[model samples]
Target: MSSIFKWEAKPFFDMVTRRQTLQAISTTALPALAGCTTDILDSGKSQTRYTLNIEPIEVSPVEHALFDPDDDALFGNPAQTALAAILPDGRHTTYGYEPLPDDAYVEYEGSYYQTTNLVTGRKQMERTLIRAEPLPDKADVPNDAILVDELNRPAARVVKILHSNAVTGGEGNSAELLREDAYVLRRPVERESRLATGELDGRIVTMTDGGNWAYRLHVTHKRITETAHTTLAIEVANSHSQFRDVVFGSRIDVELTPENLSADVRNLLEDAVRRETYEETVPLPETFEALLTALGLKAVDTAVTGKLLWYDGELYRCALYVNDSS
Candidate 1:
């Protein structure tokens, strides 16, 4: 993500004066801490803040699945066997059957078939089974029967798998099939409270002359206190109109320090920020990794709040606010 500093000299000085005035009044009016002198009054209080105004010639949206089942045990089978079965109507059909699951079912042509008396060996793999029963007719099929495609995989656009027959060791119980797919393509409706206690890295860029001039800015924040609350803002400069129709977004990965947290806490925070920010959108900027490398700092955890605007042939400014407190 890229960000541009938007401060003007006069306004910046004015803001500082205002903050100083407020600080003076508060310090004089507020009660003093017990056994503490004015010199140490700022102890235990800290803050960090930065602002950026960005103009982009283009915007883009990033799409991601809430949950992907490609690596899930119940959703995938490796080295499985595909065999042909004769239906009650004497029609030949082919399906996939795995030796791992006890149910011994075949999936083919958009349906499941229950298999029995299967004889198997290196050369006997082609022998006919004594009985292969197709699932109850679609009319009789339970309302909850999982909809599988012609490939026998869960047919719905599955976002999550809440409960599954494979997971619970059940047989022929359609209700036990994974139903989390009911929430397919659903967006999160709530924001979760999370902690920012690790390193963060991001890119910065600047553009001027109405999409004709562009350059990068290197930023680094070092010596951040352990367990500090960190927030990130990304700014983008669109110097060309070539990418006008595309939407942009960010993917952030934070590696936590195992020694600094307990297992439970680590798990809770590992992807906490990412889950919330994945849906947020952004633009292009300088490489944050380069900035960190120059500063001899490592990348860590962060949370993102995104703002996007459409370019209207006028100067567009997007602002992202970062507030760090410890």
Candidate 2:
């Protein structure tokens, strides 16, 4: 419970506080204009539902580790036991031997037990070797093998913006784009802790079982900010013979670092993305529509596009050709 509390404290606080404030403000302000156009909002023509499409988001410059509860449980346990083989019936027992009493011999009926060396008196028990099978040998490997697997494995990730107006269907703006298809590969990976104080990486990760200690991986959504405005640079180029607006199914998710994202444009992006992604089908666009409905701005609506990149710790080098933003 303490761990869960710690893991989700910020999100919970943000949600609770925001809800209380909104409720209080709505209560104070609603009655003033309560009767004006109240029924008009529910009318079919005025209440058109818009689909929000989001792009798949990736953790840029993938980090080394994350928090793993499964590994913690396994490694935290103190008592360690291993199944060992016992010798055959033709065994000799010297002094200090603790033989199982005939009445106490129900469990391991055909097995023989010998006592430990009286000098240490560790109460060690030895069984006669029957036919214990050994585990197959695995070749030596490194913990960083997942880096190779990511290139091959089929993975699911979330890509969309997050904002207050995303799912809330009122007269307010929409949500912002943050991430896409955010998912874990098989088991998550981990490593030594390296996060800001009071913050933890709760992403499940995994690695090849070679080293003695299983290292977990931590990944957090990061933003490059220069003050109040958050910035995200995307690379787009002209791919076709001429400039054109090509709208493929897309969505984006944005997770603020320390959960502090306060930008109208960013929020709109998230809302639009969420609405698009939560749809049964995503529409296609040939020309970039800057003012698609009353939603957010299309930052990049170029025909020539760059390759979709993942976290590999290198500058994403690709062509750039501008297209219509409106």
Question: How far does residue 2 in candidate 1 sit from its true spot (Å)?
Answer: 37
The Cα error of candidate 2 at residue 65, in Å, is 29
User: Quick one: best TM-score, which candidate?
Assistant: 1
Q: What is the lDDT of residue 209 in candidate 2?
A: 32
Model 1 clash tally, residue pairs: 11
Candidate 2 scores a C-alpha RMSD against the true structure in Å of 30.8
Residue 24's lDDT in candidate 1: 51
lDDT of 1 by residue, 100-170 (tens): 22223333343333333332322212111111123322343433332222111221112112123323433
The alpha-carbon deviation from the true structure for residue 155 of candidate 2, after best TM-score superposition, in angstroms, is: 32
Clashes of 2: 77
Global lDDT for candidate 2?
0.25
